[model samples]
Target: MYMLVDCSNCRTPLQLPPGAKSIRCAICNAITLIAEPRAVAPPPASSYHHQQQYPPPAPWPSPYQTPGGPPPSAHGRKRALIVGISYKYSRHELKGCINDAKCMKYLLVNHFKFPESSILMLTEEETDPLRIPTKHNIRMAMYWLVQGCQQGDSLVFHYSGHGSQQRNYTGDEVDGYDETLCPLDFETQGMIVDDEINATIVRPLPRGVKLHAIIDACHSGTVLDLPFLCRMDRSGQYVWEDHRPRSGVWKGTSGGEVISFSGCDDDQTSADTSALSRVTSTGAMTYCFIQAIERGHAATYGSMLNSMRSTIRNDLGSGGGGGVVTSLITMLLTGGSLTGGFVQEPQLTACETFDVYAKPFSL
Candidate 1:
């Protein structure tokens, strides 16, 4: 079958014929060899014993290896709990958020070396029937994230769903606290306040723990605002636009060793599509994110933020485009002290984006 291939050398997609062993892009002059899948017949029921006789070898390094005989204080191994809620009660398309979450889980497991057991997946089928990711599930997930994390541990919270915002409770016009995310069970009469979410999740995080939150929903652009936007002209780089600063607005917790990535500006609404397949439907921001991290562009948290912004800005365009509008923000808690005598470095290698258009798959 034909697969959409993005050239790591050129970062462009090319279409190839089905069953073709190799492909060469006419535009970029890049060549990619396709792997052919080998067919294997299923064993009969009586062959179960034969299969058991030749078990596969154990995976190496064991995702839970302690570096150099478990350092003092038993700094626990890094852990992650991924919650992906894609299917909405009122939506027609298959929620790609779930697919995005699963893809990240694969990256975390394979690339980041996070143990598979540490990553949790909460989909429509696995979600609790009684306590959906409504206010209840979000709260529970927060509890698990904050209380569950320990000093020297890093946690990542990625949410992909519909996000909405409202005026702050004080109702001060100049205050300008204009955006927030909407949970599964948000109602106009009773909205989920950002304060509640911060109080429950952000504020209570254990000291010395690094937290990274990625909110891939709408109305999240307020998470962080850049001082200005620059454009590269023939002469040089020039400042083109500046996001007007709004004073007296709440900027979440800044001194808590936490960073947030929001989806869109308060005035903008994120696009959720139904026509694209799950693997490819991840918002442009997320799609670019996977590409950047895998392609070795991002190493540190700060660097990751820069790469993410640049990719979204360049690939999706600034003002009007069919992509997710996302922003990244980081707040330090206690200025980051080494609580466990060991600092963990995030591991994210490089890989090209999986281009769907060139592939034979369809929605």
Candidate 2:
């Protein structure tokens, strides 16, 4: 006799002989035990077996323990890649991008205590041929960040430069636009579309790893393409909105703790300004971002968002687009309209909603 069973790893169904102790799934190639079927009918088809998705070669132990165990502390390896494109001398010359990249490196090293050597910096100023922010270099850097990542490892990717949108041929984007990152050689090497970004960075990520992205660029809200778009209210309530079902190879979440802080909405443009202190030029969103973290040290997601909005309103005018946010992001981030203010609203997108109140700002 034979019984139908789902692959323990990838969920593909297969037939198994009676009394078989175990079998390897041809689909995901995962070895799994053959257990008796449930006496009762299986739950709804929608029911999930998330653990089955993790194939053999059990993941490394997490750096953190449950609240019942040790106090909160980060362990394991940490790595980051900071990409800033000045686009100098090109038709799309951008000022302050190199500075943005350097500042981010500084923030991670000084504030987050990340080691300097572990972090990769790709900027226009770099004379090294391999370290330039060319399309190839950027992809390689992303690969470097995810490589050797273990449970509880921390990985970060920061891109401060130009972002553009193209017609979505794959139907992956509900808005019919595929957001792209313009490399220094984009005119020659082509743009890095969100699909490539997702596959390169988000797809291979294992559970228990932490990937944080700070994208200071135009149309960067979904740069990392996380599955869930979480929205919050002034009252400090949050709701997870499902990412739009799209065609082809990319979906946002990877079941890992992936989060992004983007400068603007898909239909909007972020600014490169030096208005904050008049001391140095940098991206407006970026300036407020570092400042908020520096001042608050540790604020809830809601508090951080509020602090950024308040800081920009009180200090600088809207950058690039001259408006606060596109209607899509305004509703998504604020759960309301832009009101009368004109300021670019930063966005936080994640794989899933966790304890927003408890998770600190820097993480």
Candidate 3:
């Protein structure tokens, strides 16, 4: 007899073929396993005739369970990929990128409770060739981050490096340019564009999964190509601007939740400076992002964003003449321009629209 089962991923009901132990859901393409019924206590004497006439339906197997599964945990599995490219020996070499990677890894392991084995780091200090932040390795690492993700999974992708833009030929970008991340070998391999980044990590995300990206790079406002970009002014009034492509391409997640916090807007460049800290130089955005979380200012998304902006603005200062000079000097040194006396406002983008104040910020 045929058996009815639900898809493991999408929960669509399907009919299992006779004698088949498993079946694949056509809608979500997830395989459902059929299990044999286990013996149970017989019904009471009063209902014995009814039980015999109609047997109880078999129970659906748990997707995460096995014949003898491991003990349950307090939370779902968490994974992260932290990449910091210093570009040693090159004119574009950065000092604080590797430090950012180390700090981020520590925060994830200590504060967020992510397993050390599950966190992947790619930086210039790594001796392992596979761990080096090359164009190919970063791509592979992105795939590894979301591989086998399931319900209740929390994933993070953090990049601290140079970012640039190329003209958008696909018409997907509203500004006619594609944001890009500069890998260590980007000079030779070409920069990894935002389209590819979205396809790799953003598109395949299934429902019930959450991805948060921290991008401390130039022109990274929409690095992940999320559909809604939050436009908030100093007054704290905000509106969600729709950025859907006119090409009819879908940039939103596949029922999953994705939120990105970037260093600056698409037209602006992020700062790499020693001004924010006396101990070491770091990406302005990364420093403030960590500070907001560690210092207990991140109760909600709106609060965290406001805190980051306030810190950056106060530390960098603001003046018309000084801002122009700072921008010129920054361009000469880093090959990018800054705005408002080295001010780099953090931006928030997401796959869907929600009230930032109401949604509590979590890993």
Candidate 4:
């Protein structure tokens, strides 16, 4: 006798054969565990009289099992690691990083339904020493985020802090520069380079899993070393430019999906400013990203990116009005400007190319 069950990830109905312990969903390829069948009494004649006959359940093999072997159980899980380094009492200190982490946590818990216990946060204000956003601690947290990840899992990594670029010695970087994330003790411990970041979080992902990285920092574009970068113009026309290394190195996921959103291009610097929210300083990119989602403008990836860029442009005086003059003055007073120019554009990179306008955006 076969037992009826639902796929753990896609919720597709499946029939488990006798003696089968686990089976893979034919639709989503997600592995699901099967419980032993229990005896139940048949329905009464009146109950059957009102029911229509149904087709027999489709036969799907238990890929994990052999003729007489037991199979292991697997289920998808969601996890996140959020790191915000304020570099307190230092020359490179930031005012809004910790606040960014807190806001992100709130959004994930309240909006996305990520369990509080599954989300790990590291910030300057954390009371636990292990939770401090130090170089070692951050690396370990990255490992933990993807550790034990299986097919159908969803993972996220969010960083709001200082980011920089270092000269790339390897032939992997097309522009000959590697992006980096600055930890609290970066001056002593050295910044986390893009190569290491990719190796740690991006490359190990398996098929049917997905990762979304939100980086609100300067020089963060391509920070995860994803292979394709989505280049869009002000008119919303876009193309996915190939960014694979000429050295033939693989910087993509292991059949899983990886997408990244950053504050600016590799050559530009992001602003830490109070212009976006007049009340307190915040990473401009972080502010706009949350706003895009909260305001119901993030139906697709293209829409989300466009909304973020438009908000930043208008807030920074590019839209043309008396409001522009006011924004310019406010930004100048706050010492918030991109290095080469006042422009800061958010960037998107991914392991694979897809239709940004057609693909629905989700965490």
Best by TM-score: 3
Candidate 4 local lDDT, 105-218, one digit each (tens): 777777787767678888988887768898767866776676657778789899999999999986788799999999998887779899878876787777788999999999
Residue 243 in candidate 3, Cα distance off native in Å: 0.6
Write down the TM-score of every candidate. Answer: 0.54, 0.70, 0.74, 0.73
Candidate 1 lDDT score at position 259: 52
Tens digit per residue, CA lDDT, model 1, 196-298: 5554455444446666566666665533222222222222222333333344333233223455555444555554322222223454445456656765655
Better of 3 and 4 by TM-score: 3
List the global CA lDDT of all models.
0.45, 0.67, 0.74, 0.75
Give me the runs in candidate 2 sitting further than 4 Å from their true place. Answer: 1-75, 232-238, 246-254, 275-280, 318-342
Deviating ranges (above 4 Å) for candidate 3: 1-75, 275-279, 318-341
RMSD (CA, Å), candidate 1 to true, equals: 22.9
lDDT of each residue in 92-181, candidate 2, tens digit only:
987668777877887788778786756878897887666789876786566566654667878989999999998977566767887899
Structure candidate 3, residue pairs in collision = none
RMSD of each: 22.9, 13.2, 14.3, 16.5
TM-score of 2: 0.70
In candidate 4, which residue pairs get closer than 3 Å at backbone N, Cα or C atoms, i.e. clash? none
Task: Please give the lDDT score at residue 76 for candidate 4.
Answer: 57
How far off is residue 269 in model 4, in Å? Answer: 0.5
